[model samples]
Target: MFGKTINEISLNDTAYFEKTLTQSDVFLYAGISGDNNPAHINEVYAKESIFKERVVHGLLTAGLISAVLGTQLPGPGTVYLSQDLKFLKPVRFNDTIKAEVIVVEIDYDKNRIRLNTICTNQNKEIVLTGTALVMPPRKRMDI
Candidate 1:
């Protein structure tokens, strides 16, 4: 009821959201995911590690994509089917992340859509890329 219906949505429609990750954000995500990996939570250990500093959880950044899909692109009432993600770079605390999604294909008959997803850091470096499959809202007339 919140997003564009299948008939109203078109190919190339896009949406994006940005967030600056904080140490608190990393800690909260780590606690929720139970990923107490030293590289993410312990500065000393991280400094000793190859990254030289705590690296934010990859999935934590990826979650931004889900936020875009749920609140913007296909919007509410959309059902996420599947997603394939590739991690291209590491995200550090305080990195501003931009999560974007573009509609690539729409199957009106099946009421499904395929989209390209991407997340970039402040420097416009690709941190993640992927494709998502989702069932978009049904057309009001058809329903």
Candidate 2:
């Protein structure tokens, strides 16, 4: 089914992409999203917190999934309808994180799809998991 789906549709079934989390990424995200939480930016404060180190924003990992969905898997012309996520582990700076997405369901009539999304670290520990609903480009033209 994987090979067939890949040939029939442009959407990707499963993929792995990695990025090294940096202090700059946290700071940039903070500046752009107004999420200047100490856990995300202040190493000293983070050291005293439960995590004992700076942790990236949960939304940051979630955003990575959106990137894969919009740019790689379903690619362009895909409409993001909704997403649900659960943060399982903390993501620390300098950690190499991998994000993956797989098609779970497809609604042909509405051109909608459901994908299983995941983010993990180099140790293969899952940092996040979720489901996303998107509208991929249809195979047929509508008048």
- Return the TM-score for each candidate structure: 0.93, 0.87
Question: Model 1: which residue pairs collide?
Answer: none
Q: Ten consecutive residues with minimal summed lDDT in candidate 1?
A: 134-143
The TM-score between candidate 2 and the true structure equals 0.87
After superposition, the stretches of candidate 2 with alpha carbons farther than 4 Å from their true spots are: 1-7, 10-12, 139-143
Instruction: Give Cα-based local distance difference scores for all models.
Output: 0.90, 0.79
Show where candidate 1 strays beyond 4 Å.
Answer: 139-143
TM-score of 1: 0.93
lDDT of 2 by residue, 82-143 (tens): 99999999998888899998888877667777889999998999999999998765542222
lDDT accuracy of residue 51 in candidate 2: 99
- Cα lDDT of model 1 by residue, 1-143, tens digit: 36667877889999998999999999999999999999999999999998999999999998999998887778887789999999998999999999999999998888899999999999999999999998876743221
Least lDDT summed over 10 consecutive residues: which range in candidate 2? Answer: 1-10
Clashes of each: 0, 0
| Top candidate, metric TM-score | 1
